[model samples]
Target chain A: MRENAKDPERHARRMAAKQKIMQSRIDHARKEQGVLLVLTGPGKGKSSSGFGMLARALGHGMKVGVVQFIKGKFSTGEEAFFRDLPGVDYHVMGEGYTWDTQDRQRDVAAAEAAWEVASRMLADDRYQLVLLDELNIALRHDYLDLDRVLDDLQARPAMQHVVATGRRAPQQLIELADTVTEMKVVKHAFKDQGVKAQKGIEL
Target chain B: MRENAKDPERHARRMAAKQKIMQSRIDHARKEQGVLLVLTGPGKGKSSSGFGMLARALGHGMKVGVVQFIKGKFSTGEEAFFRDLPGVDYHVMGEGYTWDTQDRQRDVAAAEAAWEVASRMLADDRYQLVLLDELNIALRHDYLDLDRVLDDLQARPAMQHVVATGRRAPQQLIELADTVTEMKVVKHAFKDQGVKAQKGIEL
Candidate 1:
């Protein structure tokens, strides 16, 4: 493939122009700090993406924390795999889906309890990466105080990263996040193809 | 929190109605097969989500194949962690970004070479999950035949799942996919806050 690098001069010229622009941008980006990442919307993989980060953080031997909300109805592959890992502090505090639970007071208590665990992770600098899995769901239903939640996130350790995932994230959280990704649904297997959730994929 | 389940009678009534509807939907969804998931858009986590699925599949002890395209210039945290795993076949087959490589002919050859490897995995049922990372970039640039790619995917083993990740996914690929997620960026650290990519997070 290296032999196929014909028109070397033309390629060099083009690359030089692009390199200058890219280098300037890189030069300007000098800040380094923790990031508040909000992963929200109707598509799949919001939680999956967060877990991906967890895996990466673990690869680097970083201490991590996981607090899962609104998803304790069944055992998940992620929880099963990550819970016993050496540097992980994993907690699944949800009672279940809102419709299944169907009790606002109970849901509120669960969210509050989950928040306590999450807040502890935020305050501690030892946890380099903390995944607040589906925390936005609790916030969406007003089970957790949005103001307090935002305050804790903002006041977290300077080098501590947080990833919050769920659907229909609060607008205020979006504004506060350093990186926000809204996963839009183009198609879904369960809804469009009559496919049930399967192990090692949706679970 | 269970003690906070006040208005038990009303809660039970609501739960029964919701359960009936959910059960009916579950009953109707009888198909069982692998999923074709496409993760695309400008937001982050497209590749991360694919890798997350990779971790979940590994947790279940499934044989997995990973082919990275247009991202072999520098090693990534995922490549480092997953490449040496027991049941994984990891291949980094790209010559780098198109701008850096700066040769359409060479890029086409590299993409073709990658497709050959991907097609082999698609044909084998022993590989339960295949992650074609950044394949959309090649497809988007017309380096590979879109129809041929789609045909190969459709003809893959019935129980073999595949995840394709990148930005600006073609419409035809989205239409053929069982699940498609378009990640919309509300904010980005590099763009909005001038923050450089960090280890174990964006790398």
Candidate 2:
């Protein structure tokens, strides 16, 4: 043990205090309802984190609906795996990245189509979890109407969770979200070390 | 079509310019090597994000090693499902949360034991990806020597990817990592809405 380590009795007392505080907090947090989670920022893993929740939802046998708003240029490992799973309604609606598609009109059309799918899923009580992958990008580019999206999200079932992921999330969405996580980029191998996206890791 | 949409020819020209820039940047990024990823901050889904990477690694037929540093209190749905899959070596190595254990010495011992397992996997070439879950917490409480942990991580195989997940990651670890994502808390349902941790979502 380190020489400066706390005595066992002292540690016990400290932990007891912590336990009491945590227990009280846990007890106080008794409310149960669905949550709207938004993952946004200039870092990696926004969609990946959303997929993690998808996996968790699937593990619990919950019905999930996934609508890819802006990612379809390259095939992702997640789409390959989760699409085959039971209780998952997966739809890849976008043609590709905005720049790759090379057409603002086409991008708007795709975003609208994706939003239609997402709105239907949000309205359906049978789907416990709905993931709108890269919806933020579409919103960022003004490819979809922000007001309509917010109104639809507000009208979702009380017990249905919704997760929207991508960079540059709208401030309105952030304000309405029950939980919002911004993935800050501390370091990125792609930018700093000239590292290409790996098969399993990045794709 | 939206009445004010950009002309198709103009949109195509703009996209062509973007594609050229993107292609040049993509062409410049030619390095291939394993990445050290750190997921840290005061928000949810740090571990969930790590699990997503684990799933991605598995989908590519990569061998994965998981050493849970401080999350053995409850049986997680992820553990129950992923443990059954082939090519995954999963070890749950903590009595429970630090407050739950209430024993500093015991917690330190458990963390050290878990580190030993992590070190071995880091050295082994068979495991392509290794996830050290809640390791930042152990390091945060000074239960483990950060220097030794850094040295071991530095000594790992060149092609092995390691992911560390937890809040308050040491600055030294962040400096060493290839990809670092800080999950900033915009809002938490537990703190703001009195929502308790759900079974599949929080377990």
Candidate 3:
């Protein structure tokens, strides 16, 4: 029995009011609203988590779109896993990582193309979820328009969730996000030793 | 300025939509309803992310509970930072990592105690989020009861969100999770050379 908060009856009512929440089924539960989320920080797994959410949304028979910015050349497990799914659309920016890119012009062009696809998904209400993988990196590098990205996310139709994953998400984006998750690195086996990234685990 | 599902929309409306989405919030997020989430796989940062979420909940005036299953004796930067945070109840299973804890009995006892705290949080909505840090490792090593854990999780209060983090989460837990995130390590900086886990970055 909870004795700390309100009256006993009120507490009881609060306790009993547990059946109303629907998890992972937010769109179905509300059918009136959606979320704009940012998964950022210096830690790894931001993109992985966003992609996981994308997979979950797709599994629910919902259409999903993915636009990977600042990442075009390398193949990710996510791409291999989700690209084949039905009703799923994907666009990978071919400029690759910043360190890997030789031409800034090419990188900017690739980022714009990726943003174009992501923008389309943002406006479309039919796609239940849109994953802007590494969009923050594009923004951080000044390849994409920060105000434009923010504006598009805000104007996105209801009943659709947009996930932006990358490190150093803009402060403005953080301020605008309904939910902002920062992945912090703590204990890593790689740093402990010489454990390298392996297949089926990393890319 | 709208696009059809089968047809691409005008680029400008799509851009406008992003603007709007940026301004709005993710209302009634899965967390508001208390979603059960599991962070698993070989990559690091699983427990770290869960802890970060725990901190976020605490910062928002939400009660939080943390049970570090396989993390003991190893003092982490996160523990130090959040140890003094308000509304955060922290408990670390002092059994250290599983590899170091060769004693099965001790490991089981540690896990059982951690589960005691976790299960209680699962039933109590006051603790909006309860994190079982490195729980999968304990579960994988058979230190914790899989069936009991799942049953308790299913019976948890709808307003309670339980996050289990670590490598190799049990099949049943993954199947039951409203959100299951598998952290994949792709080209980490530590592995590039022999850079050790720097304090404040990776403990």
Candidate 4:
């Protein structure tokens, strides 16, 4: 271990080689455009991850629009903080989760209304980042037409980054996305420890 | 569809039932203590999700401590934004990723040093949230002793929430964690689209 630690020359050579490879890759990846990201799966942090991007966009002084598709039943901490921030257009349009509503037709109407708002934001060039929170849930429940959603997404402004987050993303949306993350459930507190969602951490 | 939309009374009844159930569950979840969360697997957003929690902690006026275990080589937007914030103790104690470093002894040494900083923060009661970014990568490579890391985590203050982010979390750590998320890579831009990590999004 001591001998390995002392070999600074070899480490320097190795790093140089890596730097060359990375630089070439970086150079090759020169295309710059807004990306569509999908966060899905049965694990936690899908929405939380979307919010992180929202925060990042805010940090960059970019205009952000958020349309919550199925999470307006309970107030979240992110809403309380980012809603009041300047250059943010935040809207919570859902009545609640689908299971809580239990009315398919009503849920469909609510989702359509939410998508109307989302479509407008996607069309508007002023917004650099548009977060369609829980849109996958709406799509999964067949509350929103997949074809119409795809068409709207395709027609969005060239520089507008869109992030759709929820569990069980549709195959077509995944195919259309530049980045798709599936948050697999390794272990959940609700399932394993019987710990319900809390304010600071889970809300 | 019109008839379903007009049935407000039925919707109200269902919502009321859900409200009652949710409220009871919320009441039942009265136990409040610090949560240890592990965000792992092979996808993006592990660190991003941890940052979201950091933001939540900040919103609650809680002190935050961040130790970047394997991301010190480059300047991330999160570090640029949060490092200067009041009540945030930010430390980037890595020589980049292990693959980049390519020196096991040096990587082990760096991991130990980073863990030292993490251990101090975990022991301090002043920090309500401590984020150990990319610590799982270090653990996966066996750069730091798992038993020691678990011991330090176990000794943290009762109300100090800890979040460790990276891929391939150890099974023992998962067993001990209150919440664990595995971010599966459905589609990565680097792999599929050849999109490099962007400034505001990936960094």
Using DockQ as the measure, the top candidate is 2
* Cα lDDT for residue B102, candidate 2: 84
* TM-score of each model, paired residue for residue: 0.90, 0.93, 0.50, 0.85
Global fold similarity of model 3 (TM-score): 0.50
Q: What is the DockQ of each candidate?
A: 0.45, 0.54, 0.03, 0.36
The prediction achieving the highest lDDT against the true structure is 1
Deviation of model 1 at B203, angstroms: 9.0
- Model 4's DockQ score: 0.36
- Candidate number 1, chain A TM-score: 0.90
For every candidate structure, what is the RMSD over all alpha carbons to the true structure, in angstroms? 3.8, 2.6, 19.8, 3.9
Give candidate 1's chain B TM-score. 0.89
- Give the runs in model 3 whose Cα sits over 4 Å from its true position: A1-137, A140-203, B1-11, B17-32, B72-75
Which is the better candidate, 3 or 4, if ranked by DockQ?
Answer: 4
DockQ score for model 2: 0.54
The best candidate in terms of TM-score: 2
Off by over 4 Å in 1: A1-16, A72-75, B1-16, B72-75
Candidate 3 lDDT, B1-203, residue by residue in tens:
11221222333345456545533422212123456677776654566556545533543456778787866433354566455657878888867654344445565788898889888777787887787877877777667778899999999887676788887777888777756666655323233322333323321
Give the 10-residue window scoring lowest on summed lDDT in candidate 4 chain B: B1-10
Global local distance difference test of model 2: 0.83
